[model samples]
Target: MNITVVGTGYVGLVTGIAFAEVGHEVICLDVDEIKVAKLRQGNTPIYEPGLESYLIRNIEANRLAFTTVPTQAFAEADVIFIAVGTPERKDGSADLSYIEAACRTVAEEIRHSTVVVIKSTVPVGTNECLETMMNTISLHSIHVVSVPEFLREGQALSDTFQADRIVIGAQDAHSSELVRSIYEPFERPIFLTDRRSAELIKYGANAFLATKISFINEIANLCDELGANVDDVASGMGMDQRIGRSFLRAGIGYGGSCFPKDTKALVQIAGDVTHDFKLLKSVIEVNNTQRHRLVAMAKAHFGSLIGLRVAVLGLSFKPNTDDMREAASLVIIDELLESGAHVVAYDPVAQSQAKRILSPTVEYANSVTEAIDQADACLLVTEWDEIVDTPVDVYCKLMKNPVLFDGRNCYSLDEVKQSTLTYYSIGRNDIIHAYT
Candidate 1:
C-alpha cells in the first residue's frame, strides 16, 4: 500500500514508520522544514525509543520517506492519514484548526480514489464535518475514515506493532476494508464502527485512563490520611480478574502529550453538546491537585523552602523519552522557585528541552549526583531508573542535609529507614531523622 502520513509528530511518525516496516511504501509529510530535513537525514525529531532505528532502516530500504510537500506526497497515496496535533483550546476543546488545514490541503491535492484516515484525536462529529468538507472541495470522490491512534510516547513503536486492538470507522464497506488492509499485519481484533464512535474511542480511552490515575491519586490522598499505603491497596485490588492493574499506581498525576489535553477536551466537547461530564471534570481537577501535592510535601519537610537548595531528580513526564509536554516536574519546579528555593534539576534525556522551558530559573545538573550535591533536600519527580537506584549512602556524603522526597514513591520506606537521611514520600508516613 502507498501511504502518506500527514503531520509527523509522535502519532504521525510512528504510524508511518510502522506501516513501512510492515512492507508498505510510506511518505511522512510535515510542514516543519527542519523536522522534515532531520527525518530525511535519518534523524528523529522526537524522542521515542526504537523509533530512530526503525526510521533509519526503513529509509535505507527505500520503503519510507519524509517530505515537506503535502500535495506531492498525497497525490498517488492509497491511504492518507491526518495525524496532526489537536492541542487543547483555552475552553478545553481540541483546537481543530490544524486538522481543518490538513484536510483542505488533502482535498486540493487528492486526485485519485483515496481513503483519508483520521488518526488525530478529535470531537465526535469531526469525521462527518471532514467528509462534508472533502466532498464539497474535491472533484474526485474520496473516502474519509476515522482511525484514532492509541500509542503512548515512550513505547509508541512497541504499542503500534503489538496493538491490543484496532478501531476503524467508515461510512461504507469499501472504505472499511481499505483501512483494514492497511493494518492487516498487526493481526489484532478490529472494531468496525461509525466515524463518531472511532473518534470518541481515542478520547474515551485516554479520559478513562486519566480518571483511573486520578482515582488512585484520590485514594492515595485518603491513604495518607488513614495511615495506609496506596501500593498495597492498588496491588490487592488489582488481584481481582476484573480489575487488572495498568494505571493504578499513585503518583504526581499523568502528564505528556495525551492525557491532560484529551481529558479536558472531552469534557469541553461534552459541555458544548449540553451534557455534563462530571467524572472527567473531577479527573482534571485531581490531576491538577496531584502536581501541587509534591510541593506541599516538600514544604511539610522543610517548613519553609526559602533559601533552600532543592534537587529535582527527573524532568520528563515519564522515563525513556525526552518529550515533556505537560510534565508534573515543571509544576514542582515552579513552586520551588516561587518559594525562593534554588532549584537544581537533572534528567538523562530531557535537560536540553527542559532548559528551553526552565531556562535561567532552574539550574541544570550534569548527573543525578551532581543535582543532589549541596542540596538541602531531593524531590524524585519522574521515576527514572538512574534516580530510583541511587544509594541512600551517596546522599549522606553529597547534601548538606540528607533528605529525600519520593514524589513517585520510587524508594521503599524500609530502605529509607536504613539510611541516615530523612525521607518523605507520597501516601506514607514521613521518615524523620531519629538522631538529628
Candidate 2:
C-alpha cells in the first residue's frame, strides 16, 4: 500500500514508521520544512525508545520517505492518514483547527480516489464530519475511516507492532477492507465498529486508564491517613480476574499528551450532549491536588519550605520520554518555588525539553547524585530507572538533611530502616528524624 501520514508527532511518526516496517511504501508529510529535512536524513524529532532505529532502518530500506509538500505526499498514495494533533481548548474541548487544516490540504492535493484514515484522536462524530467536509471540498471521492491509534509514549514501537486489537470504523465496507489490508501484515485482532464508537473508544480507553490512576491515588491518600500500605491493597485487589493491574500503580497523577487532554475533552464531550460527568470531574480534581501533595508533606515536616534546598528527581511525566506536556514536575516545582524552596531537578532525558517550560529559578543537574548533593530533601517525581534504581544510602549520604519525599513510592521501608534518611512517600508511613 502507498501510504502518506500527516503530522510527525508521536502518533503520526510512529504510525508511518510502523507501516514501513511492515513492508509498506509510506511517505510521512509534515508542514515543517526542517522536520522533513531531518526525517529525510533518518532523524526523528521526538525521543521514543527504538523508534529512531526503526525510522532509520525503514528509510535505509527505501520503504519510508518524508516530505513537506502536500501534493507530492498525497499524489501517489492509496491511503492518507490524518494524524495531526487535536489540542485541548480552554473549554476542555479538542481544538480541531489542525485537523481542519490537514483536511483542506488533503482535499486540495489528492489527485485520485483515496481511503483517508483518521489516526488522530478526536471527538465523536468527527470522522463523519471530516469525511463529508473533504468530499464537499474536492472533486475526487474521499473515503474516511476512523482507525484511532492506541500507542503509548516511550513504548510506541512495541505497542504498534504488538497491539492488543485494532478498531476499524468506516461508513463503507470497501474503505474498511482497504484499511484492514494495511494492517494484515501485523496479524492483530481487529474490531469492526461505527465511526463514532471508534472515536469514543480512543477517549474512553484513556479516560478509564486515567480513572484507575486517580482512583489508586485516592486510595493511596486514604492509606496515608489509615496507616495502610497501598502497595498491598493494590496487589490484593489486582489478584481478582476482573481487576488485573495495569495503571494501578499509585503515584502523583497521570500526565502526558493523552490523559490530561483526553479526560478533559471527554468531560466536555459529555457536556456537549448535556450530560454532567461528575466522576471524571473529581478525577481531574484529585489529580490536580495530588501533584502538589509532596509540597504539603514537606511543609508539615519542616516548619516551612522557605530557604530549603529541594532536589526534584525526574522531570518528565513518565520515564523513557522527553514529554513534559502536563508533567507533575511542572506543578510540583511551581508550588515548591512559590513556597520559597530552592529547587534543583534532574531527568536522564527530559532536562533540556523541560528547560523550555520550567522556571529559570529551578536548577538542572547532570546526574541523580549531582541533584541530591547538598539538598535539604529529595522528591522523587517521575520514577525513571536512573532515579528509582539508585541505592537508599545515596540519599542518606548526599542530602544536607537526609530527608526524602518519594511521590512514586520507589523505595521500600525496609531499605530506609537501615539508613538515617527521613523517607516520606505517598500512602506509606514516613521514616522521620527528631531534629528540625
Per-residue lDDT of model 1, residues 133-215, tens digit only: 98789887878999988888788877887898999999999999989988898878889999988989999999988988999
lDDT of 2 by residue, 8-75 (tens): 98899999999999999999999999999998997889999888889889999999999888888988
Segments in model 2 whose C-alpha atoms lie over 4 Å from true places:
430-436
Q: What is the C-alpha lDDT of each candidate?
A: 0.87, 0.90
The C-alpha local distance difference test score for the whole of candidate 2 amounts to 0.90
**Which runs in model 1 stand beyond 4 Å of their true positions?**
430-436
Q: What root-mean-square deviation over C-alphas does model 2 reach?
A: 1.6
Q: Work out the TM-score per prediction.
A: 0.97, 0.98
Q: Cα lDDT of model 1 overall?
A: 0.87
lDDT score for residue 292 of model 1 = 92
